[model samples]
Target: QQQVKQSPQSLIVQKGGIPIINCAYENTAFDYFPWYQQFPGKGPALLIAIRPDVSEKKEGRFTISFNKSAKQFSLHIMDSQPGDSATYFCAASIVGYQKVTFGIGTKLQVIP
Candidate 1:
């Protein structure tokens, strides 16, 4: 099972609010978990990532909470801003060059 599902198709948050998106995977073979951020017409960039060995990971304003047993994960954005408005995608990949499976994507709009 090499499938990852994400929810909340879209989200809106006021400035300084925290927006959260959730994702779940069924492939236990997946060892690398990465969240990607994409602006309009831009390539997805790695925002923050967490390995199976860690329960959570954070980078600056972005945070990733993971649950291995439940095969679930979520991304948290702190101090939401209009500039933070973008599409976020959760992805999973194997050790090698295996294609990274991506979530349908969540559109986040931060109101000023």
Candidate 2:
């Protein structure tokens, strides 16, 4: 139950493209879910996130959704621009246990 599966190893979109990245987990103890965005030579930064109790969340141009029963979640980018192109990762962790699990990753390229 410590593993998280992610989809679409890579994605290519236009300047105004909308891309979606999905992930699934099996552990129910995970209380925190976060989406991270990483550039070519930088560390991953927190994009948007949602808790198990939350159905969805939005921040700036990013959105995240979580399904408690389905054990799934996803990240969506609206009005994607070239700056949005990066490697995205979905992660899960127990609030107080300090245990975190991360998905493989999705490499996104936004063409101008």
- Assess candidate 2 and give its lDDT: 0.90
Q: What's the alpha carbon RMSD for model 2?
A: 1.2
Q: What local distance difference test score does each model get?
A: 0.92, 0.90
lDDT of 1 at 49: 87
In order of appearance, the predictions have TM-scores of 0.95, 0.95
Mark the regions of model 2 whose C-alpha exceeds 4 Å error after superposition: none
The sequence of per-residue lDDT tens digits that candidate 2 reaches over residues 1-112 is: 4389999889999988899999999888888999889999899998877888889999888889888999999998999999888999999999888777999999999999
Tens-digit per-residue lDDT, 1-112, candidate 1: 5399998889998999999999999889999989999999999888998899999888898999999999999999999999999999999888886689998899999999
TM-score, prediction 2? 0.95
Query: Native-vs-model 1 lDDT?
Result: 0.92
Q: Using alpha carbons, what is the TM-score of model 1? A: 0.95
